[model samples]
Target chain A: MLEIFARLATLVVHDLIGLEAGTGLGDAAHFFVEDTLKILFLLAVLIYLIALVRASLNVERVRAFLAGKAQILGYLLGSTFGAVTPFCSCSSVPLFIGFASARIPVGVTMAFLITSPMINEVAVVLLWGLLGWELTLIYIAVGFLVGMLGGAFLDAIRAERYLQPFLAQAYQQGSAAAAGGGEAQRLTLRQRHDFARKEVGEIFGRVWKWVLIGVALGAALHGFVPDGWIEENLGAGHWWQVPAAVLVGIPLYTNITGVVPVMESLILKGLPIGTTLAFCMSTVAASFPEFVLLKQVMLWRLLAILFALLLVAFTLSGWLLNLVEPWLTTGAGAGG
Target chain B: MREIKVLGSGCAKCNNTAERIEAKASELGVEARVTKETSPEALMQYGVMSTPAVVVDGQLVHSGSMPEPGQIQEWLQ
Candidate 1:
């Protein structure tokens, strides 16, 4: 019995030492935890700052501005403004309600809603960071044009009647606030700070889980997915791959920030810029969550219009990306 | 005091709009009570189909756009 016990202990000790030398599991765990925590903290701080900035905005003035503009002009302006604003798809819904209630042209409101998520500052920054300046500029310009043209098309259809009944109620609330004649009060610096903190906490509290999940998936794909397979399957000149990628993106929902890392990895692996961009846009603009939220404000017909617009926009953007990929990649490789 | 409500489904934008309103109000030295209304029923009641709809003193002020800080300050004044 004593001899058997000694043999077993020796075997266990040898296996443990071998595993430690080969894997360094402890070190990897520590790194992962450290990196993830850093990301989480940064996200929190960003959320707080963004929230504070958003909180200071004047909704009534925007309403007044939109209300006074012509339909086509309103849409163009709204689209332009939306590109500068940082709201995501889900967050844009309230803005949609406000615009609709204010009796802003449906086309203009839709333009703003679409552009707000598709062509945000973060998206632009990430695109520039990962893809370079020309592609980033193209993305912004094309995205803005898509929003403007799409809104014009929808407006021609006179799609306003299709807004859900609740939108009217939302308008009523805005009017009620305006009616109260309390629009003259102001806030102090301390109050603004508290508001910013609370707003950031609340917003981040709800969406952080989704952000983390998206990041985790992106990280896994980045680390584990085979670069060779992606290049062969989805590389330029694959006619069917563009549509397939766009289709693949529709069901998946993630913020641009979460998608950026994966995009960076794919580009490194020789995936075409346009195709990857289409996929990213589809995921962000045509997400299931975004559609679900729209159900509250838009009827089926209106939703269909938005969906078709996204599909066409993404497809066109992808095609355009393919056209320039050769030149961009060559320039980048030579420069590097 | 004027009553205000920020309506949203708890997304980041909604939260941002809410905070903006608070900041704007504070900047203008407005003595208004601001609240966040996240319930679907309350949103529906206010005809808010989106998250982060701002209702000031029981009126709906903004719904879709994140208003500029100076503009919000103007509204508060």
Candidate 2:
């Protein structure tokens, strides 16, 4: 159905408008219209469905649940909760302090914080729609591992000692003085529907421009980059390429919404899958503004450690995935 | 007079919530002072995990989103 719409659009632009098929402008116009329609439709449906299923879930509940859990399980659950929770970066300071004051371990809170930016439902939906299930699953796994492992590492180093003095004291004193969350209320179907509809509006409103800008960039890359040029010059053969992509990603910032379309274009352009994913993940998760916000709760030492941890994780994942890329694509083709 | 504090990390929603409360207070002819507290310490003290939380006269009344206009009027009155 979506394909038919895209085709009709292409036909209108190509025949009714008199743009030739092979021209750069013509092809880009087709790519832009098709991608915009497909991505927006997918985003609205998937976000609403996901929101409906988890409408009862909120940060307060997540905090209460994660507080005082066992170490390993806490890390896993924290990362999982992070992915499912809809968190704005500005909430990081309050959320961080709230979790810390509740006596949740630094590592567990860090796990939630790390994964929250990298793997939200919107990110998952965009990845699945643009890159297919195999890559989406892999991206999720990588996000979890990065969060869990990073959290564990912070714990091993006793990262709590480096927190802002008040938080460190709060952690040490085991102050459950913070407001315990309200009891969970069962929601009617109507309430869930209302929540999901509002979610659709807010999330779509925030990301629609990102979709246009991202797809425009992708279409430009698709139409203009000579086929096979990237494969020949920037393929998996180069060891430094992965880290280079990650390094380039550090200064640039965009949410996963804006980066996924670019990821699709890069992969299709024959840039290695691992390299593309690494770059996009770094851009979304490891930007300066996020770190600055985190600085409210964390001292510089801990902040620096997190920065390095993310860079290393992205680079390593990039290399590992590139090594296994042919196998992955083959498996995806067969199964997905 | 009521002392209303909007707690958040200075996000746009926090500002908007403060504005709405202030507007509703005057419209209702209630003498209310609406303030934005951006400090993480203030939020931690209140135990607010989700933000744009509203504290009316030193008690948390609403949180997690911008207050509806009805909620604003109720708070003022």
lDDT of 2 by residue, A80-138 (tens): 99998987788888888878888888999999988998999888877776678889899
Candidate 1 CAPRI grade: incorrect
Tens-digit per-residue lDDT, B1-77, candidate 1:
66777777777666787788787777777887777777555664675543556777677776654666876775576
Candidate 1's C-alpha runs over 4 A off are: A1-54, A84-94, A128-132, A165-188, A329-336, B1-77
**Reference-based lDDT, residue A164, model 2:** 94
User: Taking the tens digit of each residue's C-alpha lDDT, what string does model 1 give over A1-336?
Assistant: 123332333344335433232233432332223324444555566556665565545444555556758766887788877775556565556567667666677788878877777776556654664456776776678778878888888879877767776665554444433322214337677777777787666556555665566546544544456657777876789766777788889878877666754565566567787887788778876778878877877889888878877887788888887887777633221211
Best candidate, TM-score: 2
Best by lDDT: 2
Instruction: Note the B-chain TM-score for every model.
Output: 0.81, 0.96
> What clash pairs does model 2 have?
none
